[model samples]
Target chain A: MRFSVLILGNSSATPMYERHPTSQVVNHNEQLYLIDCGEGTQMQLTRYGIKSNRINHIFISHLHGDHYLGLVGLISSMHLMGRKTDLHLYGPAPLEEILALNFKYSETELRYNLIFHPTNPTETAVLFESKLLRVESFPLRHRIACTGFRFQEGERPAKLDIDKVAKLQIPPALINGIKWGLDFTDKDGKVHPSSELTTPAPLPRSYAYCSDTVRIPDYLPSIHRANLLYHESTFLHEMKDRAVETFHTTSFEAGEIAKEAEVGHLLLGHYSARYKTKELTLLLDEARSAFPHTDLSVEGKWYEVE
Target chain B: MRFSVLILGNSSATPMYERHPTSQVVNHNEQLYLIDCGEGTQMQLTRYGIKSNRINHIFISHLHGDHYLGLVGLISSMHLMGRKTDLHLYGPAPLEEILALNFKYSETELRYNLIFHPTNPTETAVLFESKLLRVESFPLRHRIACTGFRFQEGERPAKLDIDKVAKLQIPPALINGIKWGLDFTDKDGKVHPSSELTTPAPLPRSYAYCSDTVRIPDYLPSIHRANLLYHESTFLHEMKDRAVETFHTTSFEAGEIAKEAEVGHLLLGHYSARYKTKELTLLLDEARSAFPHTDLSVEGKWYEVE
Candidate 1:
């Protein structure tokens, strides 16, 4: 299983020459999950060559334009391309109303089933669960009602020790059972312990996405120790006061949250348009001072979590 | 006056790799008018180096997502930029409902006044008028209530014949009156006819935008003899059946309409994504067979009306 995040856009409020707004795609196994689609997200997806048809679920943090503007276009395109699979959309209630009105006036009847799941951003709840992963949303502090999502991979099966299996002349079925953490029982009533024949599975990996929000310490418990954390850093340290006033976070503040939460790696993004490409280094340095694993999020870049 | 149509997006239904949905910026003098705002219009504006602050009015053809998905994002960006100028939005009534719900959920108080002018696409009405131009909407045949707009320049002043003015030793004030189509009178009551002093102004230019509509002969009366006509050509001649089935027009049909309307120049655009850039020549050729003055609408190309 591969758990990773592809940054589609990383600017805030308005798209600039240097950066875009908020959009990310989380790839887990064979499925793709979209988070907070901003303007030009479909273009970003095209630029990265990510198959948008593989995306079955979309999680929108809020009704803010920068966070969800690309959604209707993406949905409309899917229908035009003859997509028949059901699309699950999770967001605030108002988003559905907006989408419905447009569809109503356009006389557009979608070919696919659109499922809407409205959530309260102040509550912590499991949004959906699949065979390979589970998704949950928690509260975040913002000017509007916004939520953050946590994606956790399912537990993995044990790995069989090939050398031991060959030395013991074990059958393939017995090795499979051992890998499933089951002891092998022979016809002669002899039993082989699973632990002795197989190695333990690796720890399950998780990723948390915090977008368009101020630094909220209360979300630490839900997102703590995530393998990877993507947080909005809309401004540099010098704009800390502006960040607070606008209900956003600085890169340094994002790094502090990641360090306090004990996340494995931190990806800082949602940069303000005022900073050019050259000034990104200043933000990276400021963040690295608090979290060494912090890295600036660039569009089209993918981060892998092991 | 500069009468240029900046192609913000030309893709239809769903956004594709090289094409965007319907959105164009019509630049006339110092004012910028948005014709149809599709998703990612703001990014397109930024990419094309258009100043978003210059836009004072937005005219939506219908309630299709591809036509107006970018409205909320653009409005939000204006608020974020602290824009104090009032914006006039003309679209179907449902658009106001959608925007209202979005503003409520996001808890956004726009710093500028967003005047919503609900349009009855089924009727022909004068929508807006300014010192430089007048805009009126005419009925268009589509699946929904859609309308096309005609932007006509205000009446031009008569041009002064410099040699005649110099020979007659006419005062500047008298020249101004002559240009205004009034006869000049001297202190001794000697009158000079305006026609003898000045020549007629060049015909006032006009541009008609027929976006996302099927073949409609009824609109010819309203847009006849326009200086330039921009019509949506979503498909080619071979896809005539498909165009009719989807309430869209092919390049051939667009050219036919332009020929019947006796438009000075026909501009064909809104290409389907399935066709490559190389295939655009085929579209242009089809249109030229019927209307020799037809031209393909290319992005970043500017058209000036003299």
Candidate 2:
């Protein structure tokens, strides 16, 4: 039941002050999903000890260089490393053309199956679904077509009570079924309810990633009440006009969005190259002015989804 | 009069053991020329305190992802940073199509001009020439179309013998012409030979870059008697057969090439991922066995072309 987000790169537009461009990884029950892979992402993945080959799904928010520049290199590395598992990539439709042209020029036929899924940047839609997780993409207002993602965990099965199971002499094969809410029958033909053998599962957690977007109210409901929300705070309140002009979010605006959506906790990232290390606190302070429970996204750290 | 190379990355195929893919910077008289911009090259430039905007010319060796994947990102950064001067890029013909497609997808009309010059990988030809330097491209034996570059310094003007000129009371305006081997006719009607007022110019220096290639004699004459040579050594002698199959050069083979060309010094790079830090000494040892004036190309270190 491990759910966490790892920040690989957190800077905006360009890499400055030891911070790389925008990229991160989300882990749900050991399955890794990469989000917004910027330049130096592969090196960052190696630096953070994340095995990139384990990543099966990648979601690109936009086609901006800072958001998706490292994609081709990552794909090539995966191919050279002899990956055979099919990789599912979700991004803007033109990204498929970019990848095809790159591979065509390089004369490379990827050893693994690359399945591309075109994400409609104009609407909200469910991008992926599994037994344990569901990922949805929602539109974001930007200079180019962009989208944000919300990863919500589905209802988890009840945990098996090992002590109760041992005392009841439950067979090993039936234990897995019992964890899935199956009723067990005793050897003497006495029926046991599933509720008696298991503990209630925890509430499903959700994490949302919003980047390279202006402050807009249209998609507030899509990320409402998420366990953890990562919002782009490209500038401070002092640069609010610049934020509006560039279709980016100010620190205060990001905080306001988190507060309006009523998220559990707010994670701010995608900082402009203008801010130095000590000045980063000003951004956090400004965001906290609007939303009290807010923290800055630090690269190479794993933030639990809670 | 500085002629040196800074290795940004020195790995082959994939980045491993903290080594990124192949990329380097050649600095001649303060002018920067980028070669083989692999992934993370811009970041590497930043880390090494090299202002990438100063690079006016870029030479890509091949279409391999490790060789040229960072070109688009670097170009985009230059555009965003408000570059106005033209950028000269030399590579295969298809590279133009790649750049056009990338820009079309990003919806970016670059602020600066990107002047493209296609290199012929089959024949030797002078690609660029300035008053001080001449760059020539030659064929390389690789799986794909690849070219090696030779940066040769043009004939330098003679240096003024300042003490002799001062003793003779030469006028300031005439001093410049004396350095270029012009004779001075003194007001006293005395003739001063240009040789008497200036010291002989040193020999012109040249550096050759050969990478991603198998051992072949076709390009040996093009690099003969170079001041310095940077050659790819993707594998050790133990993997000689593997190197041959992959159209790559082993460490011993690279050393042999340097020996046959009679280069001033040999720089061995593009190491395979199989070698660890301690094992890298073995590569150096193997190259040194054939050519004694050989050293491994260390990233971030500047190697002067003497």
Q: Which candidate is the best by lDDT?
A: 2
Q: What's each prediction's TM-score?
A: 0.94, 0.98
lDDT of 2 at B227: 96
After TM-score superposition, what is the CA distance of residue B286 in candidate 1 from its true location, in Å?
Answer: 1.3
lDDT of 1 by residue, A1-306 (tens): 778899998888878864777899998985899998887787788889987888999999987778888887788778888889999999987789878876787777899999999977788989989756999999888888899999988887687888978877888756666877888776678887899888898888999999878887889998899999998888888898999998999989888999999999999888888888788888889888999999988888889976
Q: What is the DockQ of candidate 2?
A: 0.71
lDDT of 2 at B34: 97
Quick one: RMSD of model 2? 1.3
Task: List the lowest-lDDT window of 10 residues for candidate 1 chain B.
Answer: B297-306
- Per-residue lDDT for A1-306 in model 2, tens only? 999999999999878846998999999999999999998899999999999999999999998889998999999989989999999999999999999998998889999999999999999999999989999999999999999999999988899888999899999998878878889999899999999999998889999999989999998998999999999999999998999998999999989999999999999999998899679999999999999999999999999999
Q: What is the DockQ of each candidate?
A: 0.73, 0.71
Choose the strongest candidate by DockQ: 1
